[model samples]
Target: MQLSEQCVLITGGARGLGHHLSLAFAREGAQVIINYHRSAQAAQALAAQLGPRQAIALQADVTDPAQVQAMLATAAGHFGRPLTTVVNNALAAFSFNGDARPKADAIGWDAFQSQFEGSVRGALNTVQAALPAMRAQRFGRVINIGTNLFQNPVVPYHDYTAAKAALLSLTRTLAGDLGPDGITVNMLSGGLLRSTDASAATPEAVFDYIAANTPLRSVTTPAEFADAALFFASPWARAVTGQNLVVDGGLVRD
Candidate 1:
């Protein structure tokens, strides 16, 4: 779908990387629905900043299937049309502070389970809730947020990466199942973002190390990744689905 033709809903879009995505979509004249679980005030402020004509904020916990369904209904009602694109950008509680993370041996099933709930299950709920509308229109763009840690585990982020690995699998398989309906599912993975609520705790040295090792010799900003996200949902990507686009400045080849 063209950016201007899109009624976009970005889960967890009130702040961090989602905030950038929301802004980017609004800049292209798309109506944006900013979903927030706990950041209602921030979400409302952003929607106001983006202007009522292009943005609105709604509260929904992506982990809850019922909430997701209701949120989708509210967004479509607000726009007076079914949503054309759904950005599965919501994240379970996590931080980019590797220093405080549990080691491989110290981790347990509960740790992995939580990540799965946030990464995989939450995505499933959003996708299923949005699918009927998409199928009716035969046009939808599902952009999932992922991480490069699964491709190259430079850090010992076992639980988070494993959950994302599962999500990647869903992206491909769902692509095959949904292609005929004109809905495309793709993943946008990035390494440690230079700055975000999740990555704000990243050590400065880690950022320097990644930049020096990357071909671009720089850390990719949330805005930069947000721009690339636009492509996956745009007409240019109509032929693309079940693919992973890594935007970590060439840190991960895939």
Candidate 2:
């Protein structure tokens, strides 16, 4: 399906990478539902910028199935169409400062669980809630945001990397089960992004180091990574599912 024909829901669409995802999808003529747990101000401002007809902001904690279901219902009602595409981009509270992060020996299970709740459970809630509509229409797109750390582990962000790895596994399995239903699931992973709220704490030297290592000789921006997400939602990627397309400028080849 063309992106313009899809009613897209982007979780955590208010700030950071999600902000760019919302803009990119709207720019492609997709009806965007901006989901946010907190960032209400940013979310509302962004929806206003995108315009009410093209986009709307809804609040939901993606790990909670009830909230997710309600948000989806409201979105469907407001847009007069069920969501045809979902971008799982919400992240748990996290900072990208390697020095500040707990080492393997010092980190606790709570950290891993928090990330898991945000990454895995959150995706599960959204996908499960939207399944009926997706199945009914015989067309759906699940584009999960991932990280290249599973392959490169540059800073060894144990909790975050492990959670994203689980999310990737879920993406592939969902693709296999939903492919016959005309639903496609794929993951788009990127390395340390140039700058995002979560990555703002990253040391400048780390960004320079990544840029110097990548073949593109530049750190990927949220906008650049978000643009790749459109391919999965578009007809161009109908036959491509259960794949992890790394967007880290050749930093890691899988």
Candidate 3:
């Protein structure tokens, strides 16, 4: 019950990692606001299951500043409390098939820009939109979902990895700026989550390689990563900010 009476907003909360995080937050007694771009049915279904008093869903494309603002307004109106935590977990619908991988020389500006728009710009929009309320309440936790691939780079997800790295940079800078307002900003990076839709196309060999190489000799699950997120939002981490926690079974020790 570390998050009791807290309000949290999670982008892309309809499915996959986001979906699990939303449910985890609700179980901790948080009033959860889940944001979905295209998974309207999934969002509604999740909200219903979590119970109306603890969970609500909003539709917004995080890449658009206007949409983000509207979504925040809607959440505030419905919950009667400004968001205490914001999770920037949305990503563009890009397949990461091996053959589809773009080499540095082959990647066009559009390809790189699209990833940045969804990951970096989306985080910025959420941070900016929630700052006023956070400052007023003197408490905030901004957790950006990152990727351990940015550190190891064993597999070159050029555009996606770069975008996540940019988000990490933003998280640190925001932590410095918002520290005085009692806000903590942190990033949680995980390596090759076991059961997320994002990893559906990842080869079995790749999974086996990670499992064998990681310190724990296994892959991390979405629930485990979500628990790390919850810790950042908890009072235990009040003094912990501008940091990145790698929940990758100690695979890439940075």
Query: Which is the better candidate, 1 or 2, if ranked by lDDT?
Result: 2
For each candidate in turn, the TM-score is 0.98, 0.99, 0.97
- Which ranges of candidate 1 are over 4 A from the true structure? none
Where is model 2 more than 4 Å wrong at Cα? Answer: none
1-254: candidate 1 lDDT, tens digit per residue: 68998999999999999999999999998999999999989999999998877888999888999999999898888888888898988888888888988997798889899999988998899989988889999999999999998879978888999999999999999999999999999999998887999999899999999999999999999999999999998999999999999999999986
Q: After superposition, how far is residue 139 of candidate 1 from its true place, in Å?
A: 0.5
lDDT (CA) for every model shown?
A: 0.91, 0.95, 0.90
- Tens-digit lDDT string for candidate 3 (157-215): 88888899999999999999999999999999988888788888888888888899988
lDDT of 1: 0.91
Worst 10 residues of 3 by lDDT: 93-102
lDDT of 2: 0.95
| Per-residue lDDT value at 249 in model 2 | 89
The TM-score-based order of candidates, best leading, equals: 2, 1, 3
Q: Order of all candidates by lDDT, from best down to worst?
A: 2, 1, 3
Tens-place lDDT per residue, model 2, 95-176, is 9999999998899999999999999999999999989999999999999999999889878589999999999999999999
